[model samples]
Target: MNSSRRLVVAVAMSAAFALCLPFTANAGHDDNGTDPDNRSQAVKGFNLTANGTKAMNHGKSQLERSVITTSWGGGDIEVYDKDYGDNGWHGYADCTDWNALWTSCDIIRVRFNQYSYKTSSQWKSLGCHEFGHTADLGHRARSNDTDNNSCMREEIWPLYYDQHDLNAIKAGT
Candidate 1:
């Protein structure tokens, strides 16, 4: 029985690794055209939206815990199933505006294709990455600085907001 359990665990781990290998190998950013800066903002208040994809849903909780809890002026971050009709400021699973900034995140899409190909953790990390953009964070452009664990990094995984990310939040406030 112990041997059988071990086999099951190994199989599960292997599957997870396989699902994530492609992403790690090609961890490129969508590049929404913003330069990295330490401009922190207090985020007076904003109504954000997200699609109902599994990854987006999971990401919503993570963002709320890590990012929203620190920023956001006590407003609701709406999660919906439909895409933004006018593109004023919303998040979608299929949005092409990855990490886009237009008058404050007209949308925060997570690239729906990721939901089918990547693991929940990967999508969650990407979600945080997009949210980082909402906080006015650009991609981490420093190449030699391998110590960067910021979600703003072009590659998403082992997700967590670094101190620089926190500083970005404090830039405009």
Candidate 2:
């Protein structure tokens, strides 16, 4: 092939490969900035709020647990319940609201269902998944059941925050 033609072909192939790359299954209310240049919050904090009757129960507790455990003293992290109103809290189960600002990637709010759709364990994993997003984690493609250990995986099961997930959060920050 001609050099010019080869270069064009190579560029096309690279683009194709990038497009094929796996991404996390995320539901957001606004643009979740993927560009590192656009975000800056190094440490993330969560303000667990209630959605009216959505009391703070085991599901919320588990989500908080995931946040604390995965962070591993990454930085200033907070999880509080009961009197905190839904002022800036985002979604955890029903809907998620986020905006990757130039100053911080930390989540502004989290909204979570009381795990009415699945078992407690399943929601616990799901909670991790949602919090992972707050940590600026995207969906990752799993290679095996072991990969399911990552809270960043698109599939919510075998919920455990893997090194990859932690790294992603740190990188974003």
Candidate 3:
């Protein structure tokens, strides 16, 4: 059983790797067209290229474990880096305005900003955090009495989320 599971994981990983191909040269950006930082509504889908693809490949298992492949409107999130030619985990995720990538692919890539301020520790958790978003898991509560520190928002410093955020992710907010 363990062997079969490993085989399955390996195959899945391979397929995921295959998917990463054919998009590195052209995976685009808004190019200062519109800043997603202003939108509260779910951002659209896009592609993850080269290093972004590699980062997702590195963390794809975690994302798959968190239900990365689901038929929902959660949207696509392209993972990427400013310098795909370089070798490093940019450590970020963002959704571009990509509705044509795929209808179900609302959040296409789980991006990584190569020059981000995030460290390894933060990137590790960021991968999970974006996975949560892909799974429709938003931030969780950060109070003293809830399931704190186990989710994206809680993990974010400066207390990005409160009880409502927790309730949202848990309750699909």
Candidate 4:
């Protein structure tokens, strides 16, 4: 395989190992920053409903509402929003985390940054993106300084959603 592809595999492996499949999840609720919610947080996954899956099959769209009851360390997820805590956390207006909750039997949650119903492909891709983090996958290291426009990275994450992204999720992280 080419060096870049090898790097891809290496990155995936590194993230998986970093977790050690431990437990411990964090809470959050910065409103936009880090406002401290003092509630609870968990991520839920449901097999796409018949309609949802049908939409995907027909090139339509679908997205389930995910609530993030933030309360504490903002938990492990990085809460990002110019209006709340840091102006540019997590590279956008979303708090995302690569939490290893298996050992502790906890769960990490991610609050979708925006509300939009794009094509099913897009929504599915977004699921792939967030789920990737749930599985411990992170953006690929940058070619230049630490700023790659790659999908794993934030800059071009909205551009294209490829199979490698799916693979990363499958392989864990």
Model 3 compared with the native: what TM-score? Answer: 0.39
Using TM-score, rank the candidates from best to worst: 1, 2, 3, 4
TM-score of each: 0.43, 0.43, 0.39, 0.33
Q: Alpha carbon lDDT of residue 1, candidate 1?
A: 62
- Stretches of candidate 3 off by over 4 Å are 1-55, 68-77, 83-107, 144-147, 154-173
C-alpha lDDT values of all predictions: 0.45, 0.44, 0.43, 0.35
Over 4 Å off in model 1, which ranges? 1-54, 57-111
The numbered model that scores best in lDDT is 1
Local accuracy of candidate 3 as per-residue lDDT tens digits, 1-173: 69999999999999999998754221111112212221123322236444444344434444334312332233344444454434554344434453563322234356566565655455555555554555444344445325555535534633122333234333331
Give candidate 4 regions above 4 Å deviation: 1-86, 90-105, 112-128, 144-150
lDDT of 4 by residue, 4-84 (tens): 999999999999998887542321110222221222332332344443333222211111111223223424333221222
* Higher-scoring candidate on TM-score, 3 or 4: 3
Q: In candidate 4, where is summed lDDT lowest over 10 consecutive residues?
A: 58-67
